[model samples]
Target: MASTDMRDGLKCSICLSTSTDPVMLRCGHNFCRVCIDRVLDTQDESGVYSCPDCREQFQERPALMRNLALRKIMENFRHTKPHQKVIFCTYCVDSPVPAVRSCLHCEASLCEKHLRAHSKSPEHVLSDPSTSMEKRKCSVHKKILEYYCTEDAACICVSCSLAGEHQGHRVEMLDKVSEKKKEKLRNIFQKLTTKREKTKEKVRSLEERWRKAQETAAKEAERVTALCTDIRRRVDDLEKKVLSEISRQEKEESQSLSALIHQLEIKKDELSRKMRQIEELCNMTDPLTVLQEPDTGDLCDPEEEEGDKDTRGHVKPLHDGDDLDVAVISETLSTLCDVITGIRRGIYVAGSSEILMDVNTAANNVHVADNLKTAIWTRKNENRPETTKRFMCNQVMSRRGFTSGRHYWDVEGSRSGEWMVGMCYSRIDKRGRQSYIGYNHKSWSLWRYNNQYSVIHDSEVIQLPDKISSDRVRIHLDYEAGQLSFYELCDPIRHLHTFTSTFTEPLYAAIYVYESCATIFEDWLCNWP
Candidate 1:
């Protein structure tokens, strides 16, 4: 029972057993080095390592100090007495006598029955009975390593100090050196833990920024959707108002025609009555009746038809009429313009450069303008031989390639037809059907067909409802930041879309026109003549 109790006292708190490579924390707690390392890893994000027992936080990873005293005590601890109730006493020669105590000096265990008869010599130190004893001896010197050489950072036996490698090294008893190292480690741990906390703060900040950006993008999309709905409603109202005026004018014209027809029918009936009476009287049989008729129903007077006389092939009322007044039509158009111009948003950057078309890179049917700023698609054109730099389809690139700094330029594109504006590396595919802007990996673009706008890259299409204005489109590039954002330059620049990626090559301004045309030019902060 005494031997079992002895083994329990030396058990490590972490592993609940004897510690392998035991070390001490600044908090004076002992554990296996591997166990403490695992705990430190768990708190690596915060950089605030703490003791499991006292929860004393450290600013840095604390260096572990070898607990030589604890190691020494465990070396003599019994390995065999862990499971069995008792073992035969080393002092006994034969028979099964249970061991109670181990003599550290004599290296033998005595049973309680035998312990009572054992000598009471002070030199014969007693401990719990154990079987493992060879580990205490050093492998090199075949002696116990009781001293620690501070300079060599190693434990050494007495023989090492006399003549071996540690002969002149500064050394102390391992128990004494271990205590000093533990205190020094405590100071180092306190200072280093704070640095890791700063890193954690940075990571947290970046995550928050990303989350807020997502929310902002969602809100912007909703605003654009609502704006488009309102515009559609306004346009419909304008259309209905114009059609209603035309309908009112048509009613006025139709009513006058109906009145003229009624008058003509009445006159016809009066003449027919008169003719029947005259014809019967001419027979002489009713001569008296003809004379008594008193010339009644003499063709309805012409004055009655004089009213609205100009109704004879005349329509001056419908032409230059108030219903078709140009002033009202102009005002309606002005209002429509105001509604659209009011919605343009965002700021335009000042940096810009004039971009010129590269005729050599243009498709064979695409006509390059004299100014080198515009390209028109035509069916009749001089055929050009296929080349590596020229496009297979109706596409062209700017002469200047930007590899650094900020660049902002404007391009006027088709308002009603299909067209594309974007950036691409000079080495983009020149022959494949997917070589067109927005369809390949080397290009990013905003494409429009009628009013529907789409952002495309790597063959993936993201449709946008807001009609991208073709009056003036702005492409902003930040080379160092690896960003390309597109905008519609109106009253307030409206953001269309943005592309972000690490650019590895110089980029050229590319324009693809189909059944349309576009012109690119530099906007030098409104200094253009």
Candidate 2:
């Protein structure tokens, strides 16, 4: 059987019972595995995890170290023997006297009679009968622990705070420390309650968005399917029309060739008849008869009639298949492509308001004007005061960021050196090469340099065709769909490039200027002229 003192030693502070699946923290305190896990879970949102006993904060969740010795001792305790858990008066050496209270200062348990006879001084603090009186006293000084050392995050006696290892450390009475801890816990509780409500609202919003997305996707799919069906039907009709034209040409050419063959056959028959007549005449016995044959101008005519010659010359040849492919099929396909492009352009409506630049993030050489819609690069630095939010490079970000929905903005640039227009996360770097728009993973941009256009993201560059170069460019962003597209603003907007990526943060409009000026247009679509 285990003694009362041994039982107390093996107890868990959380359960006030023998530890089950005992685990030790780095601070040397032991708790049941289940109990500590619950405590840590509650601290997750607080951003500061701490030990339950000492309140020592940890930068991250602490690892649970199993106390194998304690586990074995508990197992042995369960198997050894069963006995009543009762404490006896320390002064009763003759007969068994049950302890009613324990004096932490004296480190002794007492019966009712003995407790009444004991000192009533405050130093002789009495608590419910506890076998582990040593736990409430300082080990080094053998004095009752009455204060909490803020520096050490441990309980200490007055002597320890004054002259012992914890000398000169800030300390507070245990009761006052407990009250402060309760107040902090109450604040955390309030914050948690608010966060819970907000999370619920977020859940509802997300559900609505999910349903809306599904409906939109279904409608779009149906429309696309219908469009494809119509395109196929139109193409089939064109095929039939082209084939019918080819068949008509073939039939006409065949009739002309057949008529010419018939004329040749008739000529052969006529020649045969004339030959027989000549043979019969040669066989004639009298020369007078042969001479009597009238001297005709011609025996058989070899030339075709005027009408027949005209008919032969007018006969048309078969049409070339290549011509059908080029004239009919090519035009049809071109028309289809135009229709599709028009649909693509019409699907997204631009309702984005005027975008304004954030002057706070502008570099020393960059200037914002025209109500924060224009950015110009000055050759000379303005020597502006330094701030962490200010960019050290020739870059500036917009004041507002886009978190959802589609947005577009048009920018007109000067035909000068280099410049860029794009979107970036608000957390983009403010200094060094990484801060350059289009140079880091946090940003994506369309860059114009040396009369060449290109798109860049995460140091990856894609050169666009020179034909897309225009004074004005449009940047379209579908935040929810994770699509960013660039277009050359012309009579018919030409698509330049598209970047697809999953975004985890809000996107802000960003610009980089070098010996150039960029002006963002208010009412981008209306200002097309």
Candidate 3:
């Protein structure tokens, strides 16, 4: 039996109570296994683990062996009479062992098994395993006090539930709060996922637009470059022609100068010889005999004045001669250059026009249906007077007018009467105007002047009453007779009207009436006598 002193009776670093299941670490320090496990479970901000007694660091999952002898001794002591007093659960007192270890702040006790289960449960309020024993606290309330009020953020002892503040508030076991928070977090994540998808769609749309714009810009750049290259090619051709023309002119001038020099030398030699002959003749003493002899030397003189005039007219000064031709050449070159410049300008203008036209056509070609689908349009009742009168007429005619054939009525009958059939027709009339005609068992009418009024008969004009319902009246037009007729029933004898119009283009008429008013129109159409 070792003496039970501070060294021998080492307390658990986690519970700060004497270690019952003592485990000796490699460093010779002893602690309850559960105590060290709790400490290891709690992670600090920096995540380092330290022993409480020696303040020494130990790796997670320390190489420790349990002191089985010490554990047995503690177990024996626990069984002693003084230590054997029953520890009953504060809540549900009938149970000897608690189901869970309530937080100290909440003042609940739990059995060993319950305590172990609760420690791992999300709803449990296990103390931070990384903290020192003295600093350990309930996870939910963070209170060192060994009691909890199950209601509303309150820390209380078992007797505190009856207090006024917590009297009505729903009290739940503190351990369940963690599970609730986790569930709430999951819901938040789900919502965030939906938002993320929407954001991704928007980003995708923007990226698509960016890609399209980039492609368009690239195409435009290519077109501009091609135009520039064509211009450069034309310029190069012009430059080459101009250089060739300059070289040809230089060669021609050199040949012309050589020919002129050769002709001048021959003229000079002839003039010198002729002068000598004239001098010899003058020196002769017997001039009459020399002239008469006509023998040895030539007696003719050179035409100096004529030759000098010809040479002066034919030969040009070197510097001045090229000036006129060069001026003409330069003017022609300048005109060609101007033409090329104009061509370049025109190309640019044409390209610009093409771009503008494309944009304009795209703008004009927008789909009407697509625009309308997203827009709300207002509909006004323009034929209120006619509509009211027609409705009344239809009701009366459908019930009283002659009926023929298998005519069906929709109103005042359910699967027992005939069904009403109707249609509407519209077309251009003779006066270059559009007309609408409606026909039914009750009556027939024409909408002329752009539906402003109804044409009832050929001889008489009648304005539709304001209270008449348009749905009650129907009209039919006969193109062969150039007449429009109305009927109250299928019988021809119940004719309502017959009107003629000076319409040239084919006219369309809409024949429609309420089922209640179909009897008269049906009888008229059936020619019932």
**Compared with the true structure, what per-residue lDDT tens digits does model 2 show for residues 350-378?**
44454789898999999888589899999
**Would you estimate the TM-scores of all the predictions?**
0.36, 0.42, 0.33
Best by lDDT: 2
User: Tens-digit lDDT track for model 1 on 346-441?
Assistant: 222233445788888999978999889898887876487778999988999989898887677888886756888999999899877789998989
Candidates sorted by lDDT, best first: 2, 1, 3
Task: Give the C-alpha miss distance for residue 97 in model 2, angstroms.
Answer: 16
What's the C-alpha lDDT at position 168 in model 3?
57
On residues 153-192, what C-alpha lDDT tens digit does candidate 3 reach at each position?
6644333444534555555544576577689999999999
TM-score of 3: 0.33
Clashes of each: 5, 0, 65
lDDT of 3 at 277: 70
Clashes of 3: 65
Off by over 4 Å in 2: 1-133, 149-154, 158-171, 185-222, 252-260, 275-286, 293-298, 304-412, 415-472, 475-529
